[model samples]
Target: MCNSVVLGVDIGTSSTKAVALTLDGQILGIATRTHQVDRSHPGRVSMDGEIWWQEFVGLCTELSPHAPGGFAAIGASGMGPTLMLCDAAGRGVAPAALYGVDTRAVEQIRQLEDAFGAEEIYRTGDSYLSTQSVGPKFAWFRQHDPEAYAAARTFHMPASLLVHRLTGAYVLDHQAAGQCSPLYDAARHRWIAERCELVAPGITFPRLAWAGDRAGEVTRTAAAQVPGLRAGAPVTVGTIDAWAEAHSVGATEVGDLMLMYGTTMCLVATQDHRVRHPSMWGSPGLVPGRWTLAGGMGTSGAITAWVRDLLGGSSYDSLTCDAAASGPGARGLLMLPYFDGERTPILDPSARGTICGLTVRHTRGDLFRATLESVGYAVRHHLETFHEAGIVPRRAIAVGGGVRSALSAQLVSDITGLPQQLTRISIGASYGDAHLAAGLLADTPPLSDWNPVVRVIEPRPEPAYDELYRLYRQLYESTRDIQHALAARHSASAGEPLPDHRATATAPERSVTAPERSAPVSPAGPDTPRSPR
Candidate 1:
C-alpha cells in the first residue's frame, strides 16, 4: 500500500499529459499526447471536448503499468476558464472555446461591462471583463448559436470535465468558478444566479470545491476504460493548470509568484488578501482563505513556434543556439509579442504583432532573438502591474515547457532584474495534480519535500534591455490605432462573418492530427518533459 501510486492527468491547449508518482513525489512514469486546436477562423481557438477525454484514456492506459498495485487516487487540471457546453448526456455541443487566446467574445465583453457597470462588475467578480472572462463567451454562444445554446444544459472546464468523466461528479474548483467573471461573486464565493440567467440562461452551474478536495470515486465505467485505475479510487477536484503548476513548485506562500512559460506566459502571485486591478485577474486560491492575482500574455512559445515554422522547420535547440549567437539587442531589432493579440494590462484583441528596426542586414536568428526579448519585456510589464496593485512577489519560480529553454528564462530575468528559481520536478501541472491527490493520504509529505528548488537564475545587468524596454512600451502606444485598423482588415479578409438572425452557420470542421506519442523520459532537471498549456 505504501508503494501504491497516484495518477495525475492534465488536458492542456496543445496536449494532455499524465504522470504516475509515489506519495513522496518520486515520478515513476510520465506520458504526453500532443494535439492541435482549431484556428480555421480568425480570433477563434477551440477543440472537441471529446478529444480531451480520449487523450485522458490514452495517457492513463500508457502510464498504468508503472503502478503495479493499482492507482490509489487520481487528480486532474487543464487550461481554463474554457467553455465546453454539453448536452443532457455530457457530450460537447460544439468545440470548446479556449481561454483568452480565443478572442471572439470581444464585443460580448463590452456588452457585459456596460450592462453590469465596470466598477460593479469588478466589485463582484474581482476582475475586469476581458477576453479571458467566461461570461462573455457564454453570451456570445447565446447570441450566435441559439439552437446549440438552447440544447446546452451544463458546462465544464478541462479539469471539471475530466472529474465528471472519471467520477460522475459535476463540480468545479472555486478558483476556476471565480474566473467566470460577472457570473461568480468572489466575496460570497458563490455563483451569481441572476448573472447566470443573463449570460447562459437555464445552464446548470457545477458545484464548487477546493482544488484538493475529494470530488468522488472513479466509477466502474471509468475504471474499465482506464487500465489499472480501481473502481473506487478517490479523485481530487483540480483547478486550472497554471494554479496547479504553482502548487507543484511550492509557490502558494504569500508574496510568491509562479511564472509559467508555456503556450502562453502566465504570472500568478499568491496572497493572503485579495488584490484587485482592472488589468489583472483576481481569484480564490487553491484552498480556502487564500487568494491569487493572475495575468498572462496571449502569446509566448506560440510565437517561438510560429518563427520556427516560418524560418524552415528547425528544432528548438538549433533555434536557441542561433538566437544566442545573435547577442543581446538582437542586432537592433525589437518585437511586440501580440501575434494573437494581447492579454493582461493591454487586453487588446485588436493588437497585432510588430517587428521594428528590421532591415536586410538582419537574419532569422535576429528575428528569433527579438521574439524572445519581446516576451521578457511583457513579463516586466506584468511585474510592474503587480507592484502597482500592492502585491510585490518576494520570490518568482519559473516552470513549464518554456523553462526548458535556458536562454528564454535568463533573458526574462535579465530584462526584469529578478532572479527565477527552477524546481526539481518540472513535469508541470500533472505533477501538481499528483500532489493534490496525495493530500487525501494521511502520511503525504510536504510539497517542499515533494519538489524543491534546484537552481536559481540570477539577473545580469544588461544596459541594452533598459533602453529596449522603454521603446517596447512606446511602440505599442504609437501603433495602436494602425494595429486596430489592420486587425479589422484582417478579420474582413478572413470572411467568416459572425452569425446573426439572417444566417446561422454550422460549426467549423474538426482537425485530425497524427496519433499521440509519448515523450521520452529524461532525468529531473531543466530538460524534463513538459507540454506547455
Candidate 2:
C-alpha cells in the first residue's frame, strides 16, 4: 500500500510556501510564491486578503500534480497574529493590518490600556498590549475606518482566513487567539467577550481549536478551486507560523528555544508552565497544556534585503561573502536593527533604525556585515531577557531561510554563546504543518525520525564581539531620543498623526453601528506589486 500523504501551506510575510509529504516524512513536492507587504506609507504594512487565497490556490496547482496518491489531510499556517477583518461572507473589509512591524495602532494601544488597566490586561492575558496585539488594531480600524468596521462581522488572521476559505469554517487556533490580548483569556483558553467588545464591539470571534485539531474537511467548492486537494480531506487548525516553525525542528520540548530567522526574526521558547513577562508574549503552545514565551525583532532579514537592494541588487551570495570578510564588529560599526521599530524587550514603536561609525572608506561589505551583526546583538538582547524572566532555554534550534547563511547563524551563536542545532530538513513552518497533519493519523512516525539534527553550531567566544555587544546596548539608550524625534518627523512628513503619548482619556466612545460615510481611507495603503520574501 502506498504511504498516505498530507499537504501544508504557509502564508508568510514575503511569500507563500507549501509542502506535500508522506506520513513517514518523505517530501513529495514543495512550492513557493513570493509576495510583499504593502508599505507605501510609513508605519503601515499590509497585504490584500485576496493575495493569500490566490497564492494558496497557485501553490496547490503547482504541488498537487506531484502527489499522485492524494492527501489524507491539509494543514495551513501563516504570519500572525494579524488582523484581517471580514464580512460574514468572508470578504475582507479592508487590507489586513499586519503584526508588530506595522506600528499604526499606537494611539489605539494607549486607548485600550486606559479603558482596561494595563496591569489587569497583563495579569489576565499574560501579555501587555503593544503593536503585536490584535485588540489595538481592531480599535484602530473602528476609529479610523468606521465603514469597514461596521461591515466587518468577524476578524481573521492569515491562518484562520485561509482555513475559512478552504474548509468553510470560521475558526482560529487558541495560540493565535492568545495573542489577541484582552480579547482572549490565556488561562481560560477562551475569548473574554466583554473585553473583546470593549475593543471590537459586536464582533463575533471564530470557534477556537488547538493548532493540530481538525478544523474541518475541505469543501467541494474549495477543492475545485484549488485543483489538487481532495474535497473530503481533513484540515488541521493551524497556528502562527513561528510556532509551526518551532515544531518543524522538534523544538517543542520544554526548555527548547526555536529561533526563526525569516523576514522577521522570531523567537519561541517552550515552557511547561506559563511564564509571563511585561515585554515578551506568553501564548498556548501547539499542544494542550504546553506554553510558550515569544519575542520578535521587527526586522532582521528585512534589513539585509534593504541594504542589498540599496547596493544595486547585489546577489545574497556576494553580499554574504563580503559580509563574512568584513569580520567581527564590522570594522567599528554598530547598528540598532529597529528599521521597523522594535517588538520584544523594548516594545517601542517609535524606535527607528540607526547606524554608528561610518567612514568614506567603508565598503558595502561593511554595511552588510554591520546589518548581520546588529541582528546578532538583538538576539542576545532577547536571550538575556529570557534569562531575566527565569525562562532560559536549555537547547536552541535555528530554522528558516536565514540559516542557509553560515555567517549569520554562526554570528548569532557567537553573540549569544549558545549552541544552535541545525536540522536536516529545514523547510520551516510549512513542513511542520505537514508534520502536524501526519500526526492526526493513527500510524504516523515520530517527528524525530522525520527531521534530525545534521550539525551543531557552537559559540566561539570573541572578546571583541563581547565589547561590541555592550556598546550596542549603550548605543540604543544614547540615541533613543534622537530616533524617536526622527520617527515623529517622518510621521509628520508622511501626513500621519504622531502617537499621543500623553493624551488624556477623553477620546469619545463610538458605537459599533455604521455612522455617516466619510471619504474612504485605506488603513494600510494601496495594493502594491508583489515582491520577494
Tell me the spans in candidate 2 whose CA falls farther than 4 Å from its real position: 501-533
Record all residue pairs in model 2 with backbone atoms less than 3 Å apart, i.e. clashing: none
Error of 2 at 368 (Å): 1.0
lDDT of 2 by residue, 354-472 (tens): 98999998989899999999999999999988886787789999999999999999999998898999999999999999988877765666567789999999999888988899999
Off by over 4 Å in 1: 497-533
Judge candidate 1 at residue 363 and give its lDDT: 90
Assess the local accuracy of residue 443 in candidate 1 as a C-alpha lDDT between 0 and 100.
68
- What's the lDDT for all of these models? 0.84, 0.84
C-alpha RMSD of each candidate structure in angstroms: 9.8, 8.7
